[model samples]
Target: MYKLFVAGALAAGALAAQLTQVSNYNNSAKAKPGMQDITFRRPWWVYVPDAVKSDALVVAIHSCQSSAQKYFQNSKIPWKQGSDRKGYVSVWPSSTTECWDVSSRASLSHDGGGDSNAIANMIKYAVGQYKIDPKKVYVTGGSSGGMMSNVMAATYPELISAVSLYSGVPAGCFVSASGASAAWNNSCSGGQSTATAQKWGDVVRNMYPGYNGTRPKMQFWHGSVDSTLSPNNYQEEVKQWTNVFEVSQTPTESKKDTPEKNYRTDDYGPNVEAIWAVGVGHSVPSHLDASEAWFGL
Candidate 1:
């Protein structure tokens, strides 16, 4: 796999990153193994870049089996590469078991409402601890974490400014772990019927009943040769998000990324984009900086 690393990155070279240990949130009680306390469930970690802007924050979620700090540290396109000099604050909350509840109906409730709400409460914590810019908050992740990135944007469109994902299925591919297990075992085969896709789009809509607000911007980066999930999953995401953003099914624009790397982008609107990199597998594209460009970071 070809990894993408931008030149002149790491503005914070040799500057030790500060990671604060957070055990609770929302003024809620600490999380118990079986209890439903919302704050600090499973001992999450937070990293506020030195000289971070009061109002800019990015919540980076990790894939299943990866811890928050480790995933953030190892990301191909680490948000903190040079983001600290730009004053970007980042939060990495560990999922209780290194896996989020994104593959189910129950996952909908995991935002801002209770102590167990990982994404929402984390954002809330940012708003409380720092002067985070409401219009600049972002969420990005890989694999299952990527799925939750889409989920958080859909569920909390009002709070999240934009979302980016790599190698993830669309939201609502399955409503339970059993279904996810079955789908994963079967290579996520063919569940994306038109109806299935539309229903999944509704899962996003229902997040805000009777909502007539602006939908958050979306970006997707998928490897063309990914074998873990069906390639159809890409369209599953494109279909769901284009519907949410109210853009036409056909992209409004298309362009090649780099002639040498076989990268391309289908732009639906100023805020919606889908990227496909040829010869890449289930990992971040070598040109993920393109996604960051769209993020306007």
Candidate 2:
């Protein structure tokens, strides 16, 4: 009995240490714009309302020509869901050149030491410093930041709970700056097969080993009229995450309630969802109550 108790105590100690002592911290990942060694945000702004403590941390990345502060205010996330004690908190972190590298040889892999890993390091910082709940952590972004959000869901699936990607592309979509420009100009108007989707899913599954953990649920949005980004990319996002969650390739629930507005939704269980906001352009939706509801914030 004594031996069993000691073993249990040791196991608990190990878990505590693992949670408290986070590793692979990249200071550059949290740096501000215009620095010697690649910058993201300096002291990334954190929002915990009323000076209250927090239970969950929401990491939001800004698009091009935006900053952490701007994303927080303009992202339109429902922060009032907090019942008490600042039910939810948000951490806004900017990215380098307003784009997250998902295609380059450096960021597409598990140990690439790319911007994806750098962002993961940033999450570790918030989790450790704020003692936030890991299960409730989330990520969301718009445009270039949206692409990085997809990279995070793929490379750091074990770390984040769910992600809402808007106007983003699948992992390994663009390889270079010129390619990104072309994809933007052409809108990446292509479809991917289930096999291809599975291959892309493997990219995320390989990020962590021996991981029998719940995959992060995914949500996506794209404007049908968004010439900046093809709406077809939304389908690819859904397919990639559907493969990750091992759910049905076909959306179990598909609908467009507001035909006049031209908005439509395709939901593949809670693991993945895709929405097309009829005539909207390349931008984040002004009202994101659905995401807050999905997260139960």
Best by lDDT: 1
Give the runs in model 1 whose Cα sits over 4 Å from its true position: 1-15, 27-42, 75-77, 110-116, 177-197, 258-260, 286-288
Per-residue lDDT of candidate 2, residues 1-297 (tens digit) = 999999999987665411022233446543222222322323355655544455777777777777665665552644333323345666666555545555554454444556666677777777877788888888888887787788777767778988877787775555454423112323343323223778767766665445676777888888877766666777677667888788888889888753225778788987788877877878747345666656656
- List model 1 lDDT by residue over 218-278, tens digit each: 9888878887655677877888887777677798988886423588888898878888877
- Local distance difference test, candidate 1: 0.67
lDDT of each: 0.67, 0.64
Error of model 1, residue 54, in angstroms: 6.4
Clash pairs of candidate 2?
31-41
